[model samples]
Target: MSANHPELLKLSSPIRCKILERVNKFKAKIEFDGRIEYAHINNTGRLREHLIRGKTGFCLRFEKPKKTKYRLFSIEVDGYGALIDTWIQGKAFERSLDLKLIPWLKGYRIIKRNVRLNKSIIDYLLRRGDEETYLELKSAVQRIDGYASYPDAPSIRARRQLRDLIRYVEDGGRATIVFMIGLRDVIGFRPNKDVDLEIHKLLLRGSQIGLEIRAIGVYYDLHRSSIRLWNPDVKTLI
Candidate 1:
């Protein structure tokens, strides 16, 4: 976090578009497409006692209810699973996790570009001063006990993006991966080895090599209508 950082790097999400709004107790009056949908989500998983609002993707605050599927990409803690990333202000998740050094980007002008490398289209290319950055976004929706992972669900694209990121970094370019923690409670993001072994391996490899990994915790308050930074204790759930 820096004092003079560009707000363009961060994204904003409104509440009206969350997948499950007010999901702690029983959800009262859920609006869907002008009408209403089912209030209670039938919890079905080996996950602990925490209630996961949505299964795969993170919790989303809707901008226009339909402007896009989800206003923002985030996942909050519920009944069973541990709290993952929360309250992401903007589109920081797509930065490939290396953008933790935002303060470093302020001194120079940024040139943005999009190029296809390997089997995926890289989200963006950023060059400031003598530094060039390639980036992608990631989520830590789930984790395995022994191995620390990010994605809770299986993502082939995530694996591809990670591999691409590694390649770019392995080359002469400065690559960054941004893992946005959408939950207020998650302490860290692991690879979820039990669920996806390849993803787990990539995570370990990414850290082993030179991929910059940074995790931020977000807490959402509907009362004041704000999402803020928070750090909570996370225990092993393996």
Candidate 2:
């Protein structure tokens, strides 16, 4: 199958590496050029499946290193590279917006980014012809049963954000929660209820009310050597 949308971002000076071990939630050890090197992990999710020992990974040299010299952004998964960096996923989402690749979000313009909503910050504040929307983005790299799942580990912060969105919707405000599936192949997106039952229940309640829940898939295409928008409207299997 061909890509549904154009390349969103290219791997900037990506270096081939192998996952040696996970140092922590924010760091990992990789072997580059047959030398052990430390890589910074951007996502906070438990990436035990992706960061396994001897798994092939791709890293970009840090412009300024504080603790590590490289940032591990993608890992080889079933011959394709799964983009695991949340920041890069955000960039891909923004690029998709700029290109109008998301049909449902067409005509919406970003009025502000990182909008403060109560105690939490939404990813984007959008305006389209007198209507405003609060949008939040979550990255899903955990693959389960041919679907992209989220929150490989429990996240109190994520639960709080969902609650805030629910409240905003209850107050007659427009809100949307978008899951950025960072995998190349998936049947659709689903909340990992087993991992976080509260998130699953909250999503159900939010959908029952007036919250717009959507998903998009973006991943690093190993054959193309660049990140491509795989699916702009991946079905939300809620």
Candidate 3:
């Protein structure tokens, strides 16, 4: 397991709030300082287990006006905090790469972000000498009965990305699918077969063909209002 990055530990503290109601999958009403406001939920997962009434969570206020006044980024679940922001996953992965926390990608340099390849725009394209690696980051927020699962909702796009990665591997190129588990204290990682069976199978086949599949656990520090790497060696159930 890798140590936490020092720079990431310096983020400003978050505002403590109580979840009043879930307006929908992407918005929620929260209470802080006796004032109620609707905040944009940064995660797309069906977080029925976490964002419930009376649950304490953290919200980051925006300095400028936008679609929503605030963003709910983390929620307390069973005494542990989960980082629900999808954006944080990408940032954390970049930091991890910079720190050489991922051993396999140690010497690789990020050549581009959102690199267009075939029918998909991958999250990153890394290069080292003559080798090029394509990487995609998927935020995993749904945890059930001690297991963390990806794509809380069915996504054809997720499957498409997997196919692209598989093709890249077939062409003698390297490809990686990273599942950044946004929650802490998960026993293992797996594809949500009940929600997306095809993705689950693709992951299995991708692993068989040298497509690197990794699951890293990430959690929000309530005291720091920052996301940190929780587990570097999170088990992959698949």
Q: Let me know the TM-score candidate 1 reaches against the reference structure.
A: 0.58
Cα lDDT, all candidates: 0.46, 0.91, 0.82
Q: Model 3: per-residue lDDT, tens digit, 88-153?
A: 677887887888777768799899999987899899999999988999988888886788888788
Q: Which is the winner by lDDT between candidate 2 and candidate 3?
A: 2
lDDT of 2 by residue, 1-238 (tens): 4365589887767898999999888999999886999999999999878989999999989898899999999999877889999999999999999999999999998999998998898899999999999999999999899999987999999899999999999999999999999897799999999999999999999999999999999888877678889889999978
lDDT of 2: 0.91
Candidate 1 residues lying further than 4 Å off, grouped into runs, are 1-35, 38-110, 113-115, 143-149, 231-238
lDDT of 1 at 1: 29
Q: Specify the highest-lDDT model's number.
A: 2
Q: What is the lDDT of residue 147 in candidate 1?
A: 29
Candidate that would win on TM-score: 2
As a whole number from 0 to 100, the lDDT of residue 16 in candidate 3 is 85
Return whichever of 1 and 3 wins on TM-score: 3
In candidate 2, which residue pairs get closer than 3 Å at backbone N, Cα or C atoms, i.e. clash? none
Model 2: CA > 4 A from native = 1-5
Task: Provide the lowest-lDDT 10-residue window in model 2.
Answer: 1-10
